[model samples]
Target: METKIFAKDQLDEAVDLLAKGELVAFPTETVYGLGAIATNEKSVKGVYAAKGRPSDNPLIVTVSDEEMIARYAKEVPERAKKLIKHFWPGPLTILLFVKPGSLPTAVTGGLDTVAFRCPDDQLTHDLIAKLGYPIVGPSANTSTKPSPTTAQHVYHDLKGKIAGIIDGGPTRVGLESTIVDLSVKTPIVLRPGEITPEEISQVLGEKVLINTGKVSDKEVPKAPGMKYRHYAPSAPVVVVDHVEDFAHIPLNAETGVMALKSELSKIDLPEENKFNLGNDLVDADHNLFGGLRYFDDKKQIKQIYVQGFDEGEESLAYMNRLNKAAAGHHFK
Candidate 1:
């Protein structure tokens, strides 16, 4: 199957395709998502097949507004309401109890709770509203691969696998939404993204706990991108906690390194093998996947060494993505 790229003005065609149960990749503020109608069992299954995503791993349902969330989810708790007021139409996904028989089991991964997000991007909002139903939109890449930020990235990974892609340009946040499980008594952050736990706590006037523990093999992940090794590139990634230690690590022609602009001078690799992520955490978040994808696309590069950042509030999401991309291959 050939993948067609649609302009923002051509979204009606894309929505029409989706209404017919065809898969379409669309942009969100966080990343491009492989989208299908949430309530359509066969269409939802096509999403898993297109991305090679595990059936047991749940997918996030995207809606245009808070009003649409009620069509799929039930019993929106008081705490979730507080969070929705502050974080909706942004990059935060809330886990809520699923409405019986509302969504297909394929969408929920057989779980009783559903994860939903209302992206801040106007293009995606308009598309969803036009479609008039929720869509299950996971990151638009093969499962466990680095999430796509640009339409080109989506085409690179999902070309010929999906029906069409809506080119809304590069994503703004460039990371997945912050996922918090409100289904439990105490809200636990399942995945960290642009929205920090500190900010969530400030809005709720209470503390939100981060789930530091691992999910066992027998357990099903409550959200997508949780159970698997995610955001990985074709080349092996090694995380360096300190920039100065780049010298101690051996380098060869097949190796490349990614560092911040401030630490570029500290890296000992050849100029061609080094990529700078610039100075700010926001910039780092924006370029993180692109840099990894750039090096991975280089046929000569076998390994990629990435500089790590301090786990401060600003850098927490950045480091979380890096850590996952490295698959825990960290050097102190």
Candidate 2:
């Protein structure tokens, strides 16, 4: 299929394709999501086929309003309502009990629960609002590659595989939404993103647990990033834990590196091989995926060296993605 790129005002084209049960990628506050009507079984399956995503890994139902979520979810608990009131139109995905037969097995991965997110993008909201239904919004990239932050990135990995793309420019938050599984008695974060567990806890007025460990090979992940080799490029990646560690790392024109401006200034690698992770952690979080994709475009890059941050509240989300992208390879 010829993948068409739609502008903000051209959402009617995207809605038309989605209405016909086609997979069209759309923008979100987080990353570009490969959208299919959450209720359309065939179209939702097409998303897995196009991304080569595992069938067991479920998708997030992206909606514009609370009413849409209510339609599919069995019930939104009082605590969940609080979270939705506080963080809706933002990067927070909550897992809830699914109303029987409300969504397709393809969307729930045959699980009893569903993940729902309302992104903080007017264009995305408008698309869903116009369509009058929610869409499954998984990162618009290949199964294990970096999540697409820009429409061009979506086209690069998914051209001809998907129907079209709604180009809402680059995503504001480079990482995916924070996924909190509230289907259980105790809430646990399945995936970390811009909204940290601490932030979630603050709003809920209770402690929230975070799942930092990897899911076992036998287990099916509740969220996308939990059991996948995600945000990785073709080249091998190594995480450098300290600024001084870069001195020990062997670098060359073909070796790609990512760090803060101060850190990049200290290195002697080729300008083309070096990607600035920005001035601080916030910038690092925003630039992490883009930096990986940048190195991916360079055919000569054999290995990538990235600056690592200590695992903490502010740094958790960034480190989580970097660690996965690097596959726990740290520069010793």
Candidate 3:
């Protein structure tokens, strides 16, 4: 299969391909998502096959309008309605009880609940609206890899496996959406992203639950990224607890460092081996995945050492992704 790269204006081509049950990757503010119409079993299955994703790992349903949500979700409670009103078209994914058989087993992963997100990107909104149905969107990368933040990153992992990619440039968040499950009686977060639980609590005027514990492999996850060893590069990553910890290590060409620009200045590591994480939490979130991929491109970077941050609520999303990539490895 030839993977054609489509520009922002060429979504008509993308719509035509998707209608034919072909897979197309499109950008959201978060990351590029591998899109297959949720109603098409074959196309949705192709998404799992192409990405080598586990069949049991559920896919997110991306919608353009409230009508689509009403059509699929079993019941959108008052709290959920307020959340959608406040956070729709943003990096918040809500898990709700979906209508039975509304989507294929391939889409729901045979689960009764579905994850729904309405992205903030105009091009993606237009694509879904024009297609006239929701699409199953998983991060457009091979299973257990760093999620693709750019079209090139998608192409790097997917290439000829998919039909084409809609190049909407670099993603803003560089991480997946915050997934909160409303399917149960009490709402709880299954995954963390740019949207903090505190922010969600503020909008709903109720305290939100945030227990991001790693679900057991035997259990089917309610959300994506919850039961996978993800965001790893070719190199091993060591999480440095403090910036001054760099002084205890030996600097070499094969050793790479990912930290804030301020922290990078204090390390004696080679400029070529360092990837800057900017100066704050937001910047760190934006650059974290790119920094991992940057070392993969270098090839010779045998190991990566990254700076760790305080476990504040605002920094939870950044730390969640970083800890996953490092697999909870702290510097010795």
- The numbered model that scores best in TM-score is 2
For every candidate, C-alpha RMSD to the true structure in Å: 1.2, 0.9, 1.1
**1 against 3, candidate with superior lDDT:** 3
- Model 2 lDDT per residue over 266-319, tens place: 888778989999999988888899999999998899999999988587888898
Model 2 lDDT at residue 300: 97
Q: How would you encode candidate 3's per-residue C-alpha lDDT over 1-332 as one tens digit per residue?
A: 89999998899999999999999999999989999999999899999999999898999999997779988888888888999999988999999998987888887878899999999999999999999999999999988778889999999999999999999999999888999988776678888888888898899888789875767878888889888888889898899987788999777889999999998998887799999999887888888888988897888999999888896877787788888899999988
User: Would you list the rank order by lDDT, best first?
Assistant: 2, 3, 1
Question: Against the correct fold, how does model 2 do in TM-score?
Answer: 0.98
Please give the ranking of all candidate structures by TM-score, highest first, separated by commas: 2, 3, 1
How many steric overlaps does candidate 3 have? 0
Candidate 1: count the clashes: 0
- Give TM-scores for every candidate, taking all chains together and pairing residue i with residue i: 0.97, 0.98, 0.98
Query: For this target, which candidate reaches the highest lDDT against the unseen true structure?
Result: 2
What C-alpha lDDT do the candidate models reach, one value each?
A: 0.89, 0.91, 0.90
